[model samples]
Structure formats: C-alpha cells, structure tokens
Target: MGDGIVVGLGPVEVEAYIDFACPFCRQFELMAGPTLDRLLEDQLITFVRHPMDFLDAVSTTGYSTRAAAAAAAASDAGMFHEYARTLFANQPPEGGPGLTDGQLVQLGQEIGITGEQFPETVRRGTYLPWPPFVTQRAIGRGIGGTPSVFVDGVAIPARPGPILTAVQAAIDGAV
Candidate 1:
C-alpha cells in the first residue's frame, strides 16, 4: 500500500525489499532486472518491490526517503521500473549529498514520467512516511537488511540464479 511497485502475473509472487542508498541493493537490482523483465513479459510471476529507507543517515541530504517518495510518484505515473533502474544506475556514493529533489524530478522526466505533479510529489515528500512502515514490516518479518527477496513467502538469496530458480520452482509446482 506504500511506495512499492508490483508487476508480473505468473503463478508465484516475488517480494523484493530494497533500499535505494544501499549499493548491494543497486547491484542486485541491476543483475535481476533482465531476468525479472523476461518473466514479467511472459506473465509467469508477480514481482513486488518494497522500497526501504534505512540508509537515510548515510546521505547528507536525506536522499533515501526522497528517492523512495519519488519512486511512489513514479509508480503512480506507471513508470516504477524505469525510474528505479535509473536511480540505481545513478546512485550517489553513501555519506555524500544524494540527488536533490530537482534531480529526482529530472530523472523522472528522463524516463517519461511527466507533469508538475510528479516533481511536486518528490518535492513534498508525499511518500516519505511509507518507508519506515515498510522497514518495520520487513523487520517484523525477520528481514534485517536490504535486497531481501522472497518467493511464495520463502526467503531467497538476492543472487540471480537462486531467485530465478525459486521463481521457476514456484511456477512448476503451481502447474
């Protein structure tokens, strides 16, 4: 219900908990995108992305929440995947001032998410409150870190092989 993206239509669901400021999450996202995209195209699974903001302190400018909120805005605009990938590709180093609200809006535009509403949403932190709730939910589920992925409620490694294998297993078992 918060700032997450849900795609795909296969028999199983993959829930990915991630933090924008985490490099490991970025790496996993990049590695997993193509495989997931293929599955989505085939309607073989449902991918749910849960964005977290545990690394807010790492960025001098509070980029974690900002980015998460921007993502929610993108989701509303139907551009979650593109916006998220762009953010990961342009991820700023931790401990530095992350991208500004303006930059986030610009990125959205670059990815075809337009209108004043998107930028205004990013600027206003509309979805800022969502990440903590998401983090709490993850913690309640015994997940302590980013890049946590689940297939049919079973924890799977962030690596491509394990994730794909688990998803395939879920698909095969369903059929």
Candidate 2:
C-alpha cells in the first residue's frame, strides 16, 4: 500500500491537515465523531482520510502503523474502513501490551482481508513516510504535544471545548 493523505472536508472543500498518531488523535476521533457523522450524513463535511503515522518511533504508534499498513493492504482488497475499525478497536495500550505482526494478520482476516499476503504486507512496512512540515508547522503553531488541529494553517488550541469550537469556527469560516 502506498502512502497518501486524504485532505478535504464538506461536500466541496473545507480544511484538512496532516494527522499523526497521538492519543489526542484518538480523542478527536471520539470527540468529533458525532459532528463528523452528521456532516457525512448531510454531506456538509466530506472528510478525507490521510494516513500519516508521525508516531512511528513512538511505541504507541508501532502497532498502529503496522495495523494501518494492514488496513491499507485491506484497502487494496476493498475493505479499508472495515480494517480501520478493527485496528482501532484492537489498538494495544501504549507502553504496555501490544499486538504482534501475527495478531495484525488476524485482524486483517477478521476484517475480511484474509490471505497469505496480509502478513507479508504487515512485515514489509509498506506505508509511505510521514509528511514533512507537519511537526514543524505544529511546533511553529506552538504545539509541543500531539493531536493539534488546524484549519487553513491556523492552529486550533488543544482543549475539548475550545478545540471543538475552533473546528466549528474553522468549518464555518471555510463555508
């Protein structure tokens, strides 16, 4: 699987940015899930999923990256979202328990990516390198930690309420 980030929102276009593997990213997944779902249903925000694994070095992302690659391979098999859900659901605890490559193939199979090719994909580390400038941009935006959200290159502050408000504002501004 190749590495390409999907960036876009709304029925037409809104704002999109590179995302890394941070706990905050998962939090955003939870926090924004509802609004994002509504947007998807209404075709108000057409989210573009970009696969970026900034946490590659971080132990937390090791499993995610492998699983993401597996999902990517599964995408080639026409089951991207299914593999994604399975991977996220089974993400191992950072700095603690984790899934091995064998486990990843298992997940792929569970998500309907069943094949001998699945494990090979996971082993090859097929995903592309993380995007450049994302960390620098985040840091330049005063982000020292992860899960930083931005719109049109403007940093969205890191707070559930503030972040949500900022995201909404960004979407509104774009519209």
Candidate 3:
C-alpha cells in the first residue's frame, strides 16, 4: 500500500483508493480524471492510485479483483494511466461477469500496452494477490468505501469540485 502506482513528480500528493467494480469509483474517475491530468501535467501534484478489490463480492465473477490485478500488470508495463482510464470508460456492471482475461488483454492492447508481457501477466494472474492486499490495507486504515481521496495525507470528499478545490488549496498553501 506504500505509494501504490505513482504518477507525476510534484511536491503535493493526491492519493485515491478505488475499486474497479464500484460505480462510484467510475464516476469519480470520469468526473475528476481530467482535472487530475491537468494537475499532473502542471506538476502540481503527484497522483497515487491504490487500486483495490473491495467490491469483489459484488461481482459474480470477481471482476473487481481481476480488473485490479490487470491494472497492476498494466502499471508494471508503464501503461497504468491509459489502462485505468480504459477500465473506467468500459466498466462492467456489478453482479455480472466482467471482462474475461482475453477481453482484459484486448483492452490493454487497445490502449497500446504492446507485447505478450501484459497479456501473459493478466492470464497468469501475476498481480492477482495485489488487489486484495491493497483492499485489506485500506480497510485497516479505516477506509470504508471506494473512491476515497486524500490530499497531503488528509481525506477529502471524493467529488470533482471538492477535489479540485482541495488540490488548489494544497498548492496554494505549499507555496
């Protein structure tokens, strides 16, 4: 759970604990991703995503775990941002079979995660244990749900506007 999949090299830290199978997490991503991207580009904040499998029981096929594991593999391939965006954009509903391993591989490929490494990692469940470990750590830290956001170690409401305001405040305070 230390540092998760980090992006950017800014002084401020923005951490998000998300579950792939959670609809609210998808909404948070869709609503706040662009703003976060802008912040990253501007080097205002270092975004750290903690992909978890907290919603695995909600998915009949354990989509949460599978998706999170795939995301970990994508992170290893240095394609985490693209793969995460793609996952949220094409998120599967809860209580149903999520994308199969092959479909996951295809999605990774569609996002330009080239080569057999990603696919083999996905199919082999190479990072399968990671999501659950993250989820447990999150729970241990009293994080009760998906889309939990933190700015400089303080929790913030997981909304686009609030998150933006908080990030801006952190930036202002840092300066």
Candidate 4:
C-alpha cells in the first residue's frame, strides 16, 4: 500500500508528510511549492507527498480525510498538484466545517479535471480510507506531525528555508 503521490523522477528523494487541514502544512506548501517545482524541473529531486488525515478530528466535517481523498481523486485525474494548491489556497479554518463534496468537485473542475470520475470518486468516498492509512503508516514510521519533510531519507525541518537548504545539500551531495 504505497500511498505517496509522487512527482518527478530526480535522483534525490524528498518526502513530505502533510495533512490537508493543517495550517502549517499549507504554509509550508505555499513557501516551498515553487522551489520544489524548480527542483523537479531541474531533475534534482523526486518529490513524494504523503497526504495524511491526522487532523481530521479538528475539523467539524472531517475535512482532512475528505480533502485528502479528494486529492487522490485529483491524482487519478492527473491534476493532483493543481487541486492541492487550490485546496490550500482556499483552506478553511480549523474547527469549522470544511468544504463540501460539491465544493471539492467544483475545485477539481476549476483545475481542468473534468469528467464524471473525479466527482463520482469524491461523492462516493472512493479513496476515503487512503488518508487514514497513510496517516497511520506515517505515525508508525515515527512521523508525529504534519509537514514533516525528508530529503534523501534525512529528516529536515518543515520550514521553507530549511527545506530548501536541505534539498540543495542533497543535490550537491549527489554530485
């Protein structure tokens, strides 16, 4: 049960454990997305995003699980990156009801992930178990929080600056 949504085929492997409902994870994404994109473009690192649901209980509607499942649907449609960014950009506050299934579908549509499969997947909760599974696996691996980052199998601070620095060091070391 490999749960990572992998992007890129670079030499160094960078894994990010995140929860959709986590504000800090959102911040990390906003801060590091571009740099990660550039690194992917340059084939410096293989980015793997492990979408977890540890924060599902924080939201009134289990937003973390729902959103992560929706992201899996987006990944099926080959639009995971866009859908994730949109979700983060429109993140609802904790303790509130997260976006409805309809809104998730709409977001996917807005990102050009059309067709019935995506919406149907969300509505049917097809990947509902995925987030929790990944969350548990992360916990089993000693990852205790969201936005945990690893560069070349070495844990690094989830902050943008440290992530960038660690990724750069990994790239350099590979040379």
Candidate 5:
C-alpha cells in the first residue's frame, strides 16, 4: 500500500487525516464524501485515509482509539472506505460513550466484513497502538488537527470545494 489504506490509482496523492470522534472530521466526511468519491472513481488522485486517535480521551471508553483500530481492521479486510463512511454517517457525539465494540462489529458486518477475525480484532483492539504511530507521523509533518487534508504533500483546506480545487490545481500544476 502507498501509506494508510490506499484507495485509488491516480498520479496525485491525497492524505486525509481524521479522528473518529471529531465532529469536524465527521462534517468533513459528510460534505466531502461525494466529491472525494467522484475524484477517486475518476482516478484523479490516490486517497489514503489515515485514521488517528487524538480524541480518545474525550469519550468514556476511548472510542477514538477503538474506532481507529477497528478501521485498521476494516482496511485489512478491504472494507476501509465503506466501513469508515458508514461509521461517519452513524457517528456518535464526541465526549459521549461513542460506539461500543459490538456496535463497531455490527457496522463492519453491515459493510460485508463479517468474518470472525474482524469482530475479534475489533473487540481486542488489536490495532490500538497503530493510531499513535499514525498521529506521530502526522505531527511530524505539522498536521495537528482532525480533517487535515494534504494534496501531493501540500496542506489543503478540509472543505469539499477547497479540497477538490486543490486537487485540480495540483493536477494542473497550479499549486
């Protein structure tokens, strides 16, 4: 894979740094999903979604880390984008209990990742330590917030229009 969960075959590389419990990231997902999906389908850019865990402490059960770990599990099962989009659509409020492991497994199952390993991996939080490394990687690159977007190594606004515009600009050699 290119970096995180690589999702397209395009010349430009786009990195989406997100936290499961971050409402802004959820909003970004809601707004940008269609546009990003179009871009990915058109092979305009390679989308690598880097799920992080900065908001784990906000939830009663460390939902951020759990969710990120589950996302890693989904990625391994070839369901990262679908499962993550579903999670975003059903996202629980920040500072709340968030989704339980069972709920996460249910969501994964809804997306067709129903293998026993998926649920077991989610419950075990096997990928718990991965988010910290992803966070540190983002931090090393000066990205400290959720919904941070990068196009070909350049930081771009997280909004849908700006993200698409930046992708186009990168493609046109304008940015």
Candidate 6:
C-alpha cells in the first residue's frame, strides 16, 4: 500500500506490500500488522498498502492473480480494506486454496459487499491486471517470492522478530 493509500500516525512511515494469496503475506498480516497498527494509531508512522496477487502458480485456492483482480475489483467498489481483511482471515495457505474468484466475491458478500458483480468483475478482468506496472516495478525491485516486503524502499530480511525490528528501526530512523 503506497501512493494510492496512506494512513498517518506519527513521524515514521510503515508501508505494507503483499499478495493476497501468499501464505507468507497472510503470516505477515497476522504478525506484523498488529504492530504496524499500533504504530499507526500512535501517529508514530504512516501506513501504506500495496496489495499484489500474482502468486497464482502456487495457489491451491485457485490463482492469486484472479484473487488479486477480484480484490482490486472489490477495491474499485470501495470494499478494498474489508476485502483484504477477509482474504487474509480465510487464507488457505501457500500452494493451497489461494482463493477462487467466486470464493473471493463470496467472502466479500460475507463481509458486506453484496453485489453479485464482484466475481464477474474478476472473471472479466475488470480490475487491475497482473504484470501491473506497480507490481512489475515491485518485482523488478527484487520481490520474486511471496511476502516480499520493503520498508521505505529497502528490502527487509525474512526472519519475523528481526524483520519487525528492522521495520520499526526504519520507522524510528525516519522520525
């Protein structure tokens, strides 16, 4: 979450880049998000979200690109954050049920987005496309794997505590 969305807190900035279908992304949400949320509420930093869904190849839920497209469509319908929360809460694991378009829409419905056009939007590729300029740019910057996250344009190391520490440290440095 970058330029399209920016939530402010304090002097630091915490931006999250993730794919809905990536297990690691889900894990990050369950883990780092809370910390980021706290940082956000304290106005200690700004939170940005760059949602990506191209990890379709490892999907057991279907294809992430489709899910991502669906999420984007949901976003277009002004249900982006809600859809994101739903998607992560019901993640099927990496290389598992990643999220079929229909399911994505169904989840949306479960979460208050009642329009039936949601799934159809994905099927029709109505939202942002994969290989999206932003996604490609992120990948080009070295995001070959799922949960490939960067804080303030710097790639973060993978271990959880260390990564969290690094992110907070980055934010601290910014302040």
| Best model per lDDT | 4
Taking all chains together, each candidate's TM-score versus the true structure is 0.95, 0.61, 0.95, 0.95, 0.94, 0.72
lDDT of 6 by residue, 31-124 (tens): 8766766666677666566766567556654466666677777776777766776788997766776656667778888888766577677767
Where does candidate 5 have its weakest 10-residue lDDT segment?
A: 1-10
Model 6 vs truth, CA RMSD? 3.6
- Compute the lDDT for candidate 2: 0.53
After superposing all C-alphas onto the true structure, candidate 3 shows an RMSD in angstroms of 1.5
lDDT scores of the candidates, listed in order = 0.86, 0.53, 0.88, 0.88, 0.88, 0.66
Candidate 6, residue 88: how far the Cα is off, in Å: 1.9
Name the 10 consecutive residues with the lowest summed lDDT in model 1: 1-10
What are the per-residue Cα lDDT tens digits for candidate 3 across 19-46? 8888999999999999999989999888
Clashes of each: 2, 3, 0, 0, 0, 13
State the lDDT of candidate 2 residue by residue for 1-175, as single tens digits: 2223332345333232323245555666666556555555665544444444456566644554555566566666766645655665665655543577777778778766766676676677664233333334444546555554554445555344654465566557752
Please provide, for model 1 over 1-175, each residue's C-alpha lDDT reduced to its tens digit, 9 standing for 90 to 100. Answer: 7435787667788889998899999999889989888888888888898988889878887788888888988988989888999999999997788998988999999989878889888888888888878788778888788899998889989988987899888877852
Poorest 10 consecutive residues by lDDT, candidate 3: 1-10
Could you tell me the lDDT of residue 137 within candidate 1?
A: 78
Off by over 4 Å in 4: none
Which one wins by TM-score: 3 or 5?
A: 3
Q: Which candidate would rank higher by lDDT, 2 or 3? A: 3
